[model samples]
Target: MSEKKKSLKITDAEWEVMRVAWTTKATTSKEVTAALNEKTEWKSTTVKTLLSRLVDKGMLGTKRTGNKFIYFPLVEERSSIEILSQELLTKVCSKKVGKVLESIINDSLLSVDDITRLETLLKEKQKTAVKEVPCNCIPGQCQCHLVS
Candidate 1:
């Protein structure tokens, strides 16, 4: 898949449609619309529009099943989240990653088990953490040059 496909930008409405497709495996536009209608005030046409946009964005794959089109997610939820997380990190200074992580941990309501899992992940990541993280900035976008 292309990088653009890997990191497809999803809107809130598109996410709602993707969630239905992901959970249901392969579903029709009517099914997606009905599922979303239970929780949202959106009309069937609005849901259909979101589904079409998702397919166009390469986030959803479509196949004709008789008179209806079945929709399935081309991108898994976990993969999409990972791409979004990496993109978010790219906007911030590498040196502030730890601080950002600390802020996230402090601001969120994590259970004891979640905290333990995070600690384990952190330990594993520390094994691969380099002493110096090289800046990938073009020129004046960040303060990496000012530091040295």
Candidate 2:
């Protein structure tokens, strides 16, 4: 897939539609609307619009079944979250990644097992991390160049 397609960002409403599609694997728009109706007050039209936007964004794939379209997630939930996380990191100062991650960990309700797993992951990542990471930001967008 193209970078633009890989970088598709989902909105809150789109996420709701995606959750239905991801869980169902393949479903008609009507089915999705019905599933959403249980939790949301959204109209069928609103759900359809979100589904169309997801398809246009390359986050979803569709197939025609009879008079309805069956939708499925083109990108998995974990993969989409990884892409969004990377995109968020790209917008921040590279040197502050640790600080940002710490802030996230502090604010999140991580279990002891989760923290232990994260610590192990961090140790593994440290082994392969480069001594220095180059900045890929546009000129004047970040202060990396000024860090000397």
Candidate 3:
């Protein structure tokens, strides 16, 4: 993650393919399509197209394994996730970030370890927590004094 990351805007379909490659370390198109089929109605060709697009976008790299190409994630999964999360958070008013995180936590199914991790993170963040988060919203998009 210390290495500079590319600003790749991955589509939802491409994310599905990337997850498979990241989980398996490497995969051929057949493996990706097979894994995706369990969760999506996408056909094999659709999965292949997404894989090709990811490769072109440099999110995925491939090596020829005899006659077939095995695809692997070029970027670390944690780095990619952080990039995407930050991108999403930037679209909303800064004041609403806590509410957004709360909503996400409520909706997600967390394991005991995950809950413990969040508690630890929250405790650390509490050290510098502000009394009020200032609204950093675009004008006309939100009701805030920061908005002209």
lDDT (Cα atoms) of all candidates against the true structure: 0.80, 0.82, 0.86
Which sections of candidate 2 miss by over 4 Å?
Answer: 1-5, 38-40, 128-139, 143-148
Candidate 1, pairs of clashing residues: none
| lDDT of candidate 3 over 51-130, digit per residue (tens) | 88999999999889899999999999999988888877777788899989999999999999999999999999999999
Give one digit per residue, the lDDT tens place, for model 2 in 1-148: 1134346467878888888888999987788889988788788888889889999999899999778888988888898788778877766767678788999988999999998999999999999998877666666877886766
Model 1 spans with C-alpha error above 4 angstroms: 1-6
Which lDDT value does model 2 have at 73?
Answer: 87
Residue pairs in clash, model 2: none
Query: Cα deviation of 51 in candidate 1 (Å)?
Result: 1.1
TM-score for predicted model 1 compared with the true structure: 0.77
TM-score of every prediction relative to native: 0.77, 0.77, 0.86
For model 2 the local lDDT of residue 8 reads: 47
Residue-wise C-alpha lDDT for candidate 1, range 15-116, written one tens digit per residue: 778778889989988888788887897887888898889888888899997888888888888887787777666667777777788998899999999999
Clashing pairs in 3: none
Cα TM-score of candidate 2: 0.77
Residue 84 miss distance in model 1 (angstroms): 1.8
